[model samples]
Target: MTLIYALEIIGTFVFAISGLRLAAKKHMDLFGATVIAFVTAVGGGTTRDVLLGAYPVAWVQDTVYPVVILLAVPFTFIFRKYIVNLKRTFFIFDTIGIALFTISGMQKALSLGIHPGLAIVMGMVSAVVGGVIRDILCNEIPLIFRKEIYATACLAGAFAFFLLDYYTTLSENIIYLITTAIIIIIRVVSIKYDLSMPKMKG
Candidate 1:
């Protein structure tokens, strides 16, 4: 499979697991957890596709996305204790998911003849809208709505991907690697240091 397809699958799995882990923490039942996982895996990409006028969206076009998410539910349930106990488990998965999806989304848009700037925005949408919807459905404050540097990491990575693709001669693999690494490092460092956007003084 191509790197883009691989990233999509990996992103779907990690994000689904993240949603399942959160659902477990919230004491949601199996059905509830499954719904959350599905939404968390497809919400962003679906939104991006719709906005870009990509027909049928992704999940509808590919059965693998939901299948991966469904499979993740059982695996996560079986290993709930181990998965949840890992250091920064949610943060780690969420960061990786965003990193992978951001570049994947940007590449998709670019392939469709989208402008680089708009493609970057689409990439951020694909990386962040899922988590936002997941938090809203769970009745929690979405990280993007808070002072957290969550979506900013996605934005940075998408911008880097755009620049590297348009202005440099970097190989596609190198561009993907660098963009994903930048996003992951930004997110990890932000969490470790409690970094966030400055709040408005009320």
Candidate 2:
């Protein structure tokens, strides 16, 4: 596989593991955990494909992503005890995964010659939808709604990517890296400092 594809695969697998671990913490059984992992890993890509008319979605066509997520489940199960209190670490990895996924989604849409604004939305969908589905399955408020700057981080990265592509001579990979880093920083720093969206007054 190409390097980019490999990075995406790793990102997907990590996100799936994080999802599976979360499911286990909620005492979900094997079937539920697997379902959560599978959906978390590919939900974003599925949405992106549907919106892009890419048909059948990517994970539907390739067994690789699904298989990777499947393998991740057991490892999570085996290590669940030692990692039970790793919420912060999970957030870090999950945030990074979405950051990269957001950039990748926007890049895919851009490469397809989609409009920039639409591409940004697609990027947000690609990063946020997967986690949203996972949270719904777990009967929790989606991370986007709860804390740690979730969707905001993804949107910020997506916009950063778009602007970098538009107004800079930066290489494509560099743009992705910068955008991902910005999202990661926002997410991590917010978590560290308790920063968040403001509450609206009635």
Model 1 lDDT per residue over 1-202, tens place:
8887998999999999988877877889989999999999999999999998999899998899889999998788788777777857767888999999999998988999999999999899999899889998898998788876888898999998888888999999999999999999998899889899878899
Backbone Cα, N, C clashes tallied per candidate: 0, 0
TM-score of 2: 0.93
Residue range 66-134, candidate 2, lDDT tens digits:
889989977787877655577766776788788878888888789899999999999998888998999
Which model scores highest in lDDT? Answer: 1
- For model 2, where is the 10-residue window of minimal lDDT? 80-89
Off by over 4 Å in 1: none
lDDT of each: 0.90, 0.84
